[model samples]
Target: MERKIKIFMIDDDPDDREFFQIALDMTGIRYTLKTAESAVEALNIFPEFLELPDYIFLDLNMPLISGIQFLQIFRESADLNKVPIIIFSTSSYHKDIEDTKALGASHFLSKTSDIDRLSEVVVSILKGNDLPFILT
Candidate 1:
């Protein structure tokens, strides 16, 4: 039997979260999605969710701690390093993408216009499919 894909989304916006859910739903991919509105919330849940996620979609711009900061913290935690992290952000800055890749991000995707693109990207990542970015 195929293992179900587990996903964790660290994004502050409710609309974006909803968009992701809809995107995933349209894909028909079996997954368990957990959402955290802030880095603190994500960190708080990390202990219990250790190595549970197959993929993590994080937003770059957030309150308090940014995605890069969160990635730094997550990387320092040995248990969290095993899960693949993808920066799903609106900013397409080369510096940000390169920085996250250097920090060990699996991929960096700029936020797309709709759920279809998001779903496509997520499906590709889950299938170990590679796509082009600033660093890929």
Candidate 2:
């Protein structure tokens, strides 16, 4: 049997999270989804997760602690820094993408209206494809 991919998503919007869950369910990808309303919540749970998630989808804009701040914190930590972190945000600004990539995000994906595109992006990330952002 193929191993199920473990995915952790740090998104503030409940609707977006639900949409992603529905999309994943429809795609039939063997994945485990975990949601965090804030980066603090994610950081709190990071240690307890049995293993590092195969993919981490993070939102750029959020209250309290932003995704960029989370990335900085994660980068400072040895244990969390090794895992693949993807900036899954609504922002499509060139500067935002560049800044995130420079800060060690594996990929910068804009929130898309198409579920098919989202699924494809997820699949590509899981398959270890050479994405357009930093893979560190």
Candidate 3:
């Protein structure tokens, strides 16, 4: 039996959070979404998690602690070794993609204003597919 997919997202933009949640809901997959506006806030609350999220959608930009910084810290946790980390960003830079992949990110997803496309991405990820943000 499939369990409810738990997703954790860290983004400072409220609109981004709301849009992503809507897209995720549209996938018709049972899920639970927990969001944090800042990496610092996310880190603080992370220890309280009773269960690990199926995936983590992380943004590259944020105040204080950038997403890249957070990724480094997050990867150090031996317990989270198997949890896939997906990079969520408006940036489609090749360097960003290469760097994150090297740092252990499973895939990169661009932040699109289109909800349908977002939903498609959500579905792809749930189906164990990748939507890589290639610079080309």
Candidate 4:
């Protein structure tokens, strides 16, 4: 049997987290989704992961330890650096996109309120058709 894709997402908003879960559930791809409300929480639980995530979706704005800061720390870690990190945020500012790309983010996906759109993007990433950057 094919192994389930392990996906980790860090976002402070509970509603946004729920939206992501719904999007993933809509996809045909088999996946296991784990989430942390903040970067600090994710870091605290990182060592306990039996299997590291195949992809990590991060939000730009949060109460503490913003996504960019987390990305810097994440890339500094030898073990975590290689994992694909996707900047999933509501911000569409050029600075945000460029900053994340420079920091080694695999892709920058805009957070859309449309569930169908979000699901489609999730499917693309899982299917390996992820473009350089995606805005939805």
Best by lDDT: 4
Clashes of each: 0, 0, 0, 0
Score every model by TM-score. Answer: 0.91, 0.91, 0.92, 0.95
Residues 68-134, model 3: lDDT tens digits: 8899999998998678888889988778888888889887888888899889877988788645643
Rank candidates by lDDT, best first: 4, 3, 1, 2
Ranking by TM-score: 4, 3, 1, 2
**Candidate 4 lDDT tens digits, 38-62:** 9999889899999789999999898
Residue 24, candidate 1: C-alpha displacement in angstroms: 0.6
Off by over 4 Å in 4: none
lDDT of 1 by residue, 1-136 (tens): 6677999999999999999899888887888899999888888898786557989999989999999999999999777788899898888887898899999898887777666778887788888876664422
Best by TM-score: 4
Clashing pairs in 4: none
Q: Which of candidates 2 and 3 reaches a greater TM-score?
A: 3
> Whole-model lDDT, candidate 3?
0.87
> Can you tell me which runs of candidate 1 are displaced by over 4 Å?
133-136
Candidate 2 per-residue lDDT, tens place, 1-136, comes to 9899899999999988987887777767799899999998998998898889988999989998999999998889887778889898988878888888888898987887788778777777888877777321
Better of 1 and 3 by lDDT: 3
Superposed Cα deviation of residue 25, candidate 2 (Å): 2.3
